[model samples]
Every structure is written in structure tokens, then in C-alpha cells.
Target: MSTITHRLPQKRHLVTELPGPKSVALAERRQAAVPAGLGSGVPVYAVDGDGGVLVDVDGNSLIDLGSGIAVTTVGASNAAVADAVAAQAHHLIHTCFLVTPYEGYVAVAEKLNELTPGDHEKRTALFNSGAEAVENAVKVARVATGRDAVVAFDHAYHGRTNLTMALTAKSVPYKHNFGPFAPEVYRMPMSYPYRDPLGDDGVAAARRAITAIGTQIGADGVAAVIVEPIQGEGGFVVPAPGFLPTLAQWCRANGIVFVADEVQSGFCRTGDWFACEHEGVVPDIVTTAKGIAGGMPLAGVTGRAELMDAVHPGGLGGTYSGNPVACAAALAAIDQMETLDLCARARAIGEIATSSLTATAALLAADGREVIGDIRGRGGMIAVELVRPGTSEPAPDLAKAVAAGALARGLVILTCGTYGNVIRLLPPLVIDDALLREGLAILGEVLAESA
Candidate 1:
């Protein structure tokens, strides 16, 4: 087996407090210069990172299970990506794809087209972020279908931009007071197996969503139906088995473009190239980012060639849409994912994490303290939902404590869910076995402490 080699030793070592003197000083400076709207998970500054550890400004080596919110799938500080970035930077910084075309952009587009779940002739448009990719996908759908109404799902998180904010479900931080959002976006029910009134019957859950779309919006009036194959920030809510296929078939029958928002679930993060392939359902359009460029800013919208090319010349692209450096990083990251076979790595990590979490849950239940409502997710993207003992009521407070406690103990984690009760674990795919187990053990310890 070809094991991935790390540049930095994979271990956690906290020298000073989490927000040490230097970080605290930087925080004070940030308070004056930066916007208060930006929230920090640990309030520490990072100077270096590799494998699964992020070295803070205070010299605290913390095990990184968040992966910069799943952006650094190859590794936090990938040498291949850095080399590609530097080589490209040494040539030209930006010529703007609109002004002068570059092969790096075309190469990335070709890679996305070849990898994005279908053999059909495909076209791609690159963007600077996930939100832009999603927005452009919607635009392509509307233009192709000649319809204005787009349907999004409950518990879905598309992005933070105006159109995507309309697609997102949560309000407090992502969408609160940030609208008059874009018009014509409708919310439908998602096949959230945990909380669905249909009781894990995915066919019925999908039927309800399809019925709502047909009755409320009229199938012919809808331009697109967008959903995350596995909801990320809305909680790692893996839909029941039959939900996605049913929706895809229904969209095909209705001529509505079916979009898979794979921003958080793509590039071998979920033990697959794309999460939609787990069910063998191919989307008409796909939005990808997060794990694409190994921490560089890049996103893509890939779809059927006819639909993407329907837009006239000069209809798509931005100044930095496919910056040379970003494209180079993306190519290198894709190579790393392939050479390392991170898909298999993700599945192996999933088994290890699931076993540890399941054991912890059983131990808690043995003590009559069943605070974990559920432990679910695939591959490297896993989560545990905290709930009041013996009840389904969300325990956001408990989740918050678990996160804070983990950070203090030198393990970095994150929380999500509409109710804010999910602790998501997203370790880098190249994490060493011992390091991964050690990090998960810290998580188990934190949960036990909460119990």
C-alpha cells in the first residue's frame, strides 16, 4: 500500500493556552481592523500546518479535524499544490480569462467535465467561490429552461451570496437581515431521515417534496431543483436511499435541471468522486468547490454542454474566474487525490471514526445518559448530534460545550445544523492512523465529559 507521507509530524502539542499572548494581541488588533460579523472558532492565529495538525502563532500544534471547513482535503499545507502555485505565480499573476485565455483554466474545465458524474458532453464555467458557482448554475438553468422559479430544499446550504442565501435554510447567521433575497426561489422538504415525519421512508419523503413542487409551483414553471447530496452546514443529513433518485427522475420528466451541490461532498471526501454517484444518479448540473483546489480559492459549474453553451459569448466569466495559480493548484490537488487514492482512504477513516463514536454512544447509553441523538455521515465527513437525554430536543448548548472543550484540549472541531446541535468531524484525508485515532479519542473524551 502506498501510504501518504506528511511534511510535518502528525501530533498534537499545546505549549501555551489556546489563545496565547501573541494570538490575544492579534485578536485585539483584529477587533479594531476587522469586522465584528466575522466569527472565529478558536480565536487563534495559524503560522504553519501539514498532515492533520495546524500550528498556531502561539506554537500550539492542534489536531485539525475541521480541515478549514473541508477545504484542505489533500492536506493543510500540500507541497504539490504550493509548488504548482509558486510555479504559476512566477509566470503571470492574472490576465483575466475574459481578456486572454489560459490552458490551465481549460485543463481544469476538462478535468471537471471528465470527472463530474456523466459521460455526456459537458461544459464548465469556473468561479472564485462556491457561491458564485451555485449562482451561475442557477443562471444556466433559468436560461436553458426559459423558466424563472427554482426549487431548493429545507436544511439545504448553498452559499452566502444573494441568490444562494435565498437557497440556504438557516437564518441567524447566513440569511438573517440579508434579504430582500432574490425572487422566485422556493423551499421544498428534504429527505432528512432523522427528523422526517415520514419516518425514514425516503420514497414517501421524496413523494411529499415532488407533490409540493407539482401542486404549489407547477412542475412546468420550475427551472431547476437544487439539493446537496449530503447536506453539510445544515447538518451531515444523509438522505434516505430512494429520495435522490426519485427527485432526479421527477426533474428529468419535468425538464427541470437537477443540480447536485457537491461543494462539501466532492473530490473524494465521501469515499466517492461525487456523492451523487453513491446512488448512480447523474445530475444535469453540478456545483463544486471546497475540496477542489487544496485551499486555493476556486469553484466550478459543470453541466450538459448544450445547457452551458446556451449562454451567448461574454455571458459567463469574471476577472479572476479561473486564475492561473488557482487552476494550477486544482490540477495538482486532483493529482494528489488520484495518486493517493483518497477515496479509499476516506472510507477507511469513516470506519474507524464510526466505530469509535458508536462505542462512545454505547458507553453513554450504558450509563443511562443517551445524549447523542445520532451519529451519521460517510467517509471523512462525519457528525454527532447532541440532544436532551431521552428526548429529541436539540442540545445546542451541549454541542457548543463539546466544541469549546475539544479546542481547549488541542483538537479542532466544528458545529452545524439548523438547530446548532451537530458536531462535524472533517479531518484531512492524509491524516496518519495514529493521529486520526488520537484526535477521535479526544472527541470521545470530550463527549464523555459532557455526559
Candidate 2:
């Protein structure tokens, strides 16, 4: 019922400028220690986080609208998760689930099996990151189907691993100079409602992709069709209604595994346990992370038992897979999510964000600014796609400025998309309504000023 935990004030307060003296010093230390490849969206250094605010090293409390990139949905300081992690660390941190199979790991698998879409008998394997989960999911599909080729959609972002890089559509930062990527990966069109070449017919979009896969990669040779139920890095594009269903149906009909990369859209962040539930389209495999362990490093691939079990026992585990402490955190996080009914909370957040963003878009349009070309997403995962003043051309610079402005005003936001023109809002599910409203209001003000 509270926004801030640890007795930290819930309200966003700026005691000093962002990246103040202490934070600037820490940034210098970070630059000396951390690799340049790892980029930080916000320059400030955080020392504490609770509820919806991140308290920086300089004592500036910034409202968290990004949820640590959607990984802290239960808030950054959930008592349940913190207690479980501490208790588990005291008992046993790691025996590598593969080496000494812990009950916590099994319990997490059970939870994922029950919560993910569909009633079919399911099994789950834990991994260390979303990229690992995706790689494992593809391994399961490939082994199950005995096919080598996989199909991914445009604007899709799977991961940074070589296989995932091949699966990803964007090349500049994600895939550039990372090749030669995994071979036999095919790219197909997604059912992007905003950029649909064939109007907004989900069925037609599916047909287009299906036909292309068959013609280009031969559907028979394709092992899986992997996609984000609602494209995440691809501008939070909520595909046209029926789009996922049609794709799922096609995959089933063609013996191709339909894998939903719910890494960013899962775990009640999308109003449901999984985004696939919105369209009632059950994926053959679902890869999840980022919020699965309440900010802990954990990921999972849950899917039908037949396909999951198809992988040879030794073929599936990593040294750190399902670290006992992370397993404990996941279990506790899951408990908190269900008890708090974060699904409904996400829905409520979605309503607020979408309404506010849509209203802002309307206002901008009325003023002929037209910076916000589209607003879409589900549950707590929402985004505003910025475009040029009068055209649909992406305005990535404007998006950057708006995020910078919000940051300067003690608000933390994240921007992502293939073209980098999307301002995504993924607040913690447990955030207080008042704080959430304040953050959104700041976003509106920033947009208005930027326009």
C-alpha cells in the first residue's frame, strides 16, 4: 500500500542537480572500471531503490518509470524477495541446480508451468538471462523438430548472443560487427499495426509472414517462429488483434514451434501472466526474464513438456543456471505477484499511461506538432512513438531530448525501438497511484515542452 520502502520518502525529490558531485565522482570510477560497451541510459548513480523511486548517490530521488528496464515490477525493494534472498544466501547460495538440484528450482519450474499460457502439460528450465533462455528455447525447438532453420520478425530483438543476434532485426548497435551470426536464421515481417503494409488485418499479416517463410526458408525446414507477443524493442508495437493467434495457429498447422519471447512482456507486466493470454494464443515455447526474479538475474524457458523434455538432460543446464538464491527470489517474487494481483495492477497502470499518452498525442496533433505518431502497448508496458512534426518519420532525437528532460526533472524513463524513437514506460506494478500519476504528468510536461 506504500510506494517507498526502507523508510525512504516515496516522493521524487531533487536535493541536487542530476549527476551531482558524488554521482559524478562515482561515474568517473565506473568509467574507469566498467567497459564502454555497457551504456547507462541515466547518468546518475543509484544508491537505494524502493517502491517507484530510485535514490541516487547524491540524495536525489528520481521517480522510476522504467522499472529497471521492466525487471523490478514488484518494486525494487519487495520485502518478500529481499527476505527470501537473504535467507537463501545464509543457507546455500549455489550448488548449481544441475549439480545438486534444489527444491527451490523445481518449485520455480512448477510455478512457471502453471502460470504461463495454456493448460497443456508443461516443463520449464531456468537460465541466467533472457538471452540464455531464448537460446535454450530455440535448442528445445530445434531438437524437438529436427529442423535447423528459425524465423524471426522485423524490429525483433532477441538478445546479444550470436544466435540471438541473428534472431534480432536491428543491426546498428545490436548486430553490427557481431557477425558472422548463426546461419539458417530467417527474417519475416511482424504484424506491426503502426506500419502495416497490408492495412491492419492480423490474419493477412500472418499470411504474409507465413508465405514469406515458406517461400524463403521453406516452412518445413523451419524449426520455430519466434516473436515478442507485443514487440518490445520494436517500439512496443502491439500487433493487430488476432495477429498472434493467426501466427500461433499457423505454427501449429505447420509443425513449427511458436516461441513467444516474453522476456520484456511477461510476469504480469502486460496485464496478464503472459501477453499471449490477451489473444488466447498459446505459444509452444515461452522464454521469460526481466521481472521473473524481482531484479535478480534469472530467466526461464517454459513450454509443452514434449518439446521441453525432448532436450537431452545434459543438453540443457549452465553452471549458474537456477542459482539457489535466485530461485528463492523468483519463488518469493511469484508469491508476491499473485498475492498482490499485479495483473490487475498492471492493467490499471496501462489505463492510466495509455489514456494520458493518448490525450497528449491528441493535444499535440491539435497543435500540429504531431510528435507522437502512435501510442500502444498493454498493461504496465506502454510506449509513445515519436515522429516528425507532420510525417510518420521517426524522431529519435526528439525522443532522446524528452527522456533527457524527464531525467533532469527527477524522473527516470527508458527509450527503445528499432529506430530508437520510442519512449517506453514500465513502472513497477506495486507503484502508488499518486507517484505513478506524478511521473506520467512529468512525462506529459516534458513532451509538451519539447514540442
RMSD list, candidates in order: 0.8, 1.4
Q: For this target, which candidate reaches the highest lDDT against the unseen true structure?
A: 1
Question: Candidate 1 has which clashing residue pairs, if any?
Answer: none
Model 2, 38: alpha-carbon shift in Å?
Answer: 1.2
For model 1, the superposed segments whose C-alpha errors exceed 4 Å read none
Locate the minimum summed-lDDT window of 10 residues in model 1: 1-10
C-alpha lDDT values of all predictions = 0.93, 0.91
lDDT of 1 by residue, 11-127 (tens): 999999877899999999999999999998777899999989999999999999999999999888899999999999999888999999989999999999999998999999999
Residues forming the 10-long window of minimal summed lDDT in candidate 2: 1-10
Model 1 scores a TM of: 0.99
